[model samples]
Target chain A: MYLLRRGDPTMFETFWRGPIGESATLVIPGYQTMSYFSDVGNLCWFLEPGFEREVRRLHSLVGNAAVEGYHVLVGTGSSQLFQAALYALALPTANAPVSVVSTTPFYSMYPPLTDFLNSGLYRWAGDANAFDGDDYIEVICSPNNPDGSIREAVLKSKSGKDIHDLAYYWPQYTPITHMLAHDIMLFTVSKCTGHAGTRIGWALVKDKEVAQKMSKFMEQSTIGVSKDAQLRAAKVLGAVTDGYEHQLAAAAGGDANLLFHYARRKMAHRWCALRAAVAASGIFSLPNEVAGFCTFTKDTVTSNPAFAWLRCEKQEVEDLESFLRENKIITRSGTKFGADQKVVRISMVDTDEAFGIFVNRLATIK
Target chain B: MYLLRRGDPTMFETFWRGPIGESATLVIPGYQTMSYFSDVGNLCWFLEPGFEREVRRLHSLVGNAAVEGYHVLVGTGSSQLFQAALYALALPTANAPVSVVSTTPFYSMYPPLTDFLNSGLYRWAGDANAFDGDDYIEVICSPNNPDGSIREAVLKSKSGKDIHDLAYYWPQYTPITHMLAHDIMLFTVSKCTGHAGTRIGWALVKDKEVAQKMSKFMEQSTIGVSKDAQLRAAKVLGAVTDGYEHQLAAAAGGDANLLFHYARRKMAHRWCALRAAVAASGIFSLPNEVAGFCTFTKDTVTSNPAFAWLRCEKQEVEDLESFLRENKIITRSGTKFGADQKVVRISMVDTDEAFGIFVNRLATIK
Candidate 1:
């Protein structure tokens, strides 16, 4: 019911909704991958070797992240990985819970999730820019959620650490401006290939101690991530790379089978449609468009974010989400993102039909 | 390295190590189940409808659990569901964290996992029998881990709650004593089908509000269980039911394709071998074997537990785990389960070769 009322990240469904043969299908026999330990010798004991290999291969192909020296740790999702990172960075012997801060208009779930357990190891300290504490863990979500702005860690305290949520750093959402080499970087198959139900996410950690600590947290929490999901994710990601390699071999400049190319085109079209609707409405405004030279794409490409941060121009429209709901649309209020209520975050990743209806409702809202 | 020194439940691998054709296989297409939401109308929005159906069907078939009028909430594993139950039962508005207790000789992972996050919501207070708190959560692991003792909640305080860990309460490990209708009963596919790597677990929650709270905790932790794993678990469980149905149609009483029958036979044989070895050794003792009339199998059968609670008879052998290590037979010390140091938990569910070697080593020990 909640999904019917709101648009989650189902936008990429349009591209892969139809039958595409066995390009990315996964087949598992009755007697395979039944053990809990995938690679016991590896630091992340539960991580499947095949999954790890595909993850590194995809990242290397996209040139989005540095995976050479990093240890890849799989989690149920980036959400689990985020908490694991916090657990890894927090000092167990500290007198007080370490403050976890992120910039305003951050991911709305961050605060609630961090404080959900009322954990003694860490607590949500909102707004990294406003955080005055010396001991803190700052999260930097590039091509940030809600606003689609590029970000970096604001607090540089000696005791402070950073967790880079690069969930949207893929070529379709944002340009691979550079190879991200951070202390801890997060990525997920949900945004990468729209396989949200797979619940497979990974982190590339620089420090072995932090990696082990995160893996320990995983062991304590979920035992480990699902091997079924990991194997499926590997297959899906492998298919994606196969598409690109196939295109490269043909040299036909046609991206009919390529996932990123197809997704990039769809996202670009949706962004254009949404921008036109917002401009024509005259009562709404969006963040100025940004572009960059993508190292992977080898071209200057416009940033097409997974979400649209829209602000109401009319003074009477204090709660934009409520206002949109009145117009038969739904959106998350910016208040949840630690921003003004007049601004709401609209997901641009809904199905093409849903996206069309949303834009039509927005254009006529005035 | 840790797994190398310990026997973790890998015994079921022998049954599933061979090709069983497509009986329990899972094939998923690239575009299938890409959305995060699965049966959003249900209390557990992330739960796949097919998975839920199979869970209920399997419970009815085994006559081991009451699934009607219950909300089945899935988790990463029973480990996650155990914590979820604790979270649901813990009063968030209370001034102090609720005490969590289990009987002595509890699952070894319970205490550390409960306290790992240093959660202010709940803390591990060992031994429910010794606990004197009015408001506490008691975990009852029937056909309990490490010791294989059938247990019941000892604490009946007015404000006390119970979470039944029925991971080993299956036809293979124990008889179908009754249809368990506890407030919250946890089970996992890892133990049920020996697909530990699938990492899928479910709880039959009796209360709506409690189920919702558990689902919320799941959302905050891992967002949701993996659809791929859930689908695979559903297929695997469905295959088990099919095996039994095939036998019923034939009316032959022969149980070749049935999973529980095969596993039960294997377990019973291993137990017989282990008992003979222990008796021959004359320096070790084991828990007395018990039996019950099983409704599922329609016969009185001897109890064959998944773990052997072995105690060294030698008074000088203070550390039994170290003693076993010297003999190249790895086992978990009873100290971890809050038991005497002279005893250790040996997994009876290992590969046939490994079990054969273990019993031989036991028989040779003075």
Candidate 2:
């Protein structure tokens, strides 16, 4: 008898739906009232009318060069658009062995989503070192998830056909225009607008057929992103662009300058704090800052943990996870991100206060 | 050369992303006032603590039922849940062939959604006039769309498997409990709480494996319905149920009595108007009144002779549709519904003023 299962019943179930019964609410220091839904919604509105208008205006401000066709189809959040693109392009045909190719240590969700969509029919070909055209479809996320490494332009696909997920190509990180030359460009309001809940994203595609197919797939898949979210996002995008323009107009000082100044100071403070904490413990080591995350390895002097710990083996990381969970501090293990058990990922997306709390907690780990 | 296509250039463009462009601003009447984002956000709260508290209170009021191992999974709208169930239950690998079986003259979206999901991979196995489980998945919608006929017991497979879609089983229509004894029970808030914009619906299944599979598919497909939408739906559901109970207490009447009273009164008014119109024409024939919609054939004669007094032929129905469009009225032609082209479906789901306008417009056809 085939007894049906209820829940995902897997170690990665949280990724499937997030901590089911836990309070994920957190209070950011400077940002008192942070609603992911509102932030994301504000970003969405710009994609509709306001953003489109701004893009046209930007073109005029820059030069007479036409904006690439691949830079248009924006969405509720990049996540929503990414899923739609997968459905639209990935057809489950015997002749067309649908395969997804992505560089290792990329955005964590890619492999799982690919697996879920595959339904055991297709699988992810995770070998960036030896990626080939036989993979059919390739997903590349620049300024990748954990390490935040941006692929240089020289690393183009051998077949010259690939879906470039430029999800993190904000002006602050990489030149946004540089990534627009790809056949598909994915951008999300979550990382840019700092609104993880609004769930809005977009894909700019040069191919009309691909765009139409993706749209159709989206319609069939989720029936489009929430209209309210999209409209709100458009509004936020307009406000941000306006702010950017005002900064540009200011003579000696502007919003852009102020933003850069603030970001630099904040990054320096956090980096120092992180460095001090790691050095004092002498148990964990981290590479230089990449994108929004810092990768860490365990120290050799420490007892070899079972899981992905600097000093411990793979099993120690799991034990450490249990220890952290008991203290209400949740950290993602490297295994979840398709990395060696010795490595763990920490997001720097949190505010100073939260980061401080996290740093302090880790400092006590020694 | 590979040409890149962008945007949807097809007739059945996906409608799941909420309305786009000018239509985005158009509020769906009665169902929801806030934009889709707000609705989704509100609905997502249901999955939160405060909202779950309310849900528990409501469950207590309704008495303890066996809800173990079954948790609610929401969708963009009931339309999405309907499609999800089809995807979950349909055999991925069938030997002879697999078909979707629905009663003739059922919810119109079923065939189209099935076709869209199938993408020419599978086809609907016409009405289950003969209950043969040799090659089909039987789909039955009680209190059906278009006709609104309530089926007491749907036809089951040879092995006793059944899929029941109870899209409309509110106190306003019929006293009904979801037929959970079946393999799957599909329900939606669009018809019940009237929150179409929330786009929240759920499927009740006895099989855990099926539920998990469907949930996994949905996570990758749409990444779980908008959290905001689910919470709002929970709020509406709680309030609506309370309102129904209060209304029932004030009237000192049971749900069936109230439902019968409203249904009979509305049916009488529409039937009277329709009968009078047909009597005056002396050449129109009407179907027996069983549900909210009725089919009528044109056979009237008039002296002005602009009356293209004709039989219900395929070409004539097409011509009538063009006529209606010209007058700024829209409707589903019989051809689209798999009905005889000579007969057109006239819906009573509109307001009285709209119905009056329709009557006046029909009078002009003479």
Best by DockQ: 1
Instruction: Tell me the spans in candidate 1 whose CA falls farther than 4 Å from its real position.
Output: A1-7, A17-21, B1-8, B17-21
Models 1 onward score TM values of 0.98, 0.65
What's the distance in Å from true for residue B44, model 1?
A: 0.4
Please name the candidate that would achieve the greatest TM-score relative to the true structure.
1
Cα lDDT for residue A306, candidate 2? 9
Kindly list the per-residue Cα lDDT of model 1 for residues A91-110, writing each as its tens digit.
Answer: 99999999999999999989
lDDT of 1 by residue, B5-40 (tens): 333457766555543336788999888878889986
Worst 10 residues of 2 chain B by lDDT: B3-12
How does model 1 fare in lDDT? 0.88
> How many clashes show up per model?
3, 71
Per the 3 Å backbone cut-off, how many clashing residue pairs does candidate 2 have?
A: 71
